[model samples]
Target: MNVPTEHLLILSAILFAIGMGGFLLRRNMIVVLMSIELMLNAANLAFLAGARQHSAQAGHWVAEGPVMVTFVIAVAAVEAAVGLALVIAFYRRKQTVSLDRLSPTGATSKAN
Candidate 1:
């Protein structure tokens, strides 16, 4: 059974919007990181949808989309690792994950 490509794209768009909203509105470092991940997953959905649509039209799927998605997932994993490490280090120094509480140097500062 095949699903409609437009539906997948719509879902992807929705996920990306929600992720952007969370990233912009949330103050916690971890939540921001999670929003970034959600955006990445939305991109993956778009890639898969494109691949499926291509397969439907051409009678065979190209490996490009899935291969690119694999690379994206790898990059996302690395991003999450580095982001979490920074968040942990910041929390260790400032005792808070709130972005508003952090200074440019990752230290605590008076909120303006």
Candidate 2:
């Protein structure tokens, strides 16, 4: 059972597109952040597949790739933490998570 590189590329492209769509369409900050993470993972998958297809893939350690992925995951985690904190504070002040209710000036109605 052999898989072609083209198939992997196509799959990666599709995953990236779906992730982008999710990021664009979602209003929830958490969901949007997750979509961004998905897009990054899709790109990482494509990079690894391409590396596998190449004859002279640098570095003997597979851990290198995973380390980079781990870094990305850490970044995503930090982003999620910060974003969720902001969302929580916003909800506390405004009583809503809807993006439409958020104001740029941080002035929320007290009548929630």
Q: Quick one: best lDDT, which candidate?
A: 1
Query: What is the Cα-based TM-score of model 2?
Result: 0.74
Please, what is the whole-model Cα lDDT of each candidate in the order they appear? Answer: 0.92, 0.75
- The lDDT of model 2 is 0.75
Q: Against the hidden reference, what TM-scores do the models get? A: 0.92, 0.74
Residue 66 in candidate 1, Cα distance off native in Å: 0.3
Model 2 segments beyond 4 Å from truth? 55-64, 109-112
Question: What RMSD does model 1 have?
Answer: 1.6
Worst 10 residues of 2 by lDDT: 55-64
Question: Given candidate 1, what's the lDDT at residue 8?
Answer: 97
Tell me the number of clashing residue pairs for each predicted model: 0, 0
Clashes of 2: 0
Question: Please, what are the lDDT tens digits per residue for candidate 2 over residues 1-112?
Answer: 2577788778889989999999889887668777887888787787666655662345454455566666777877888789889889887876777776766777864544
What's the CA error at residue 109 for candidate 2, in Å? Answer: 6.1
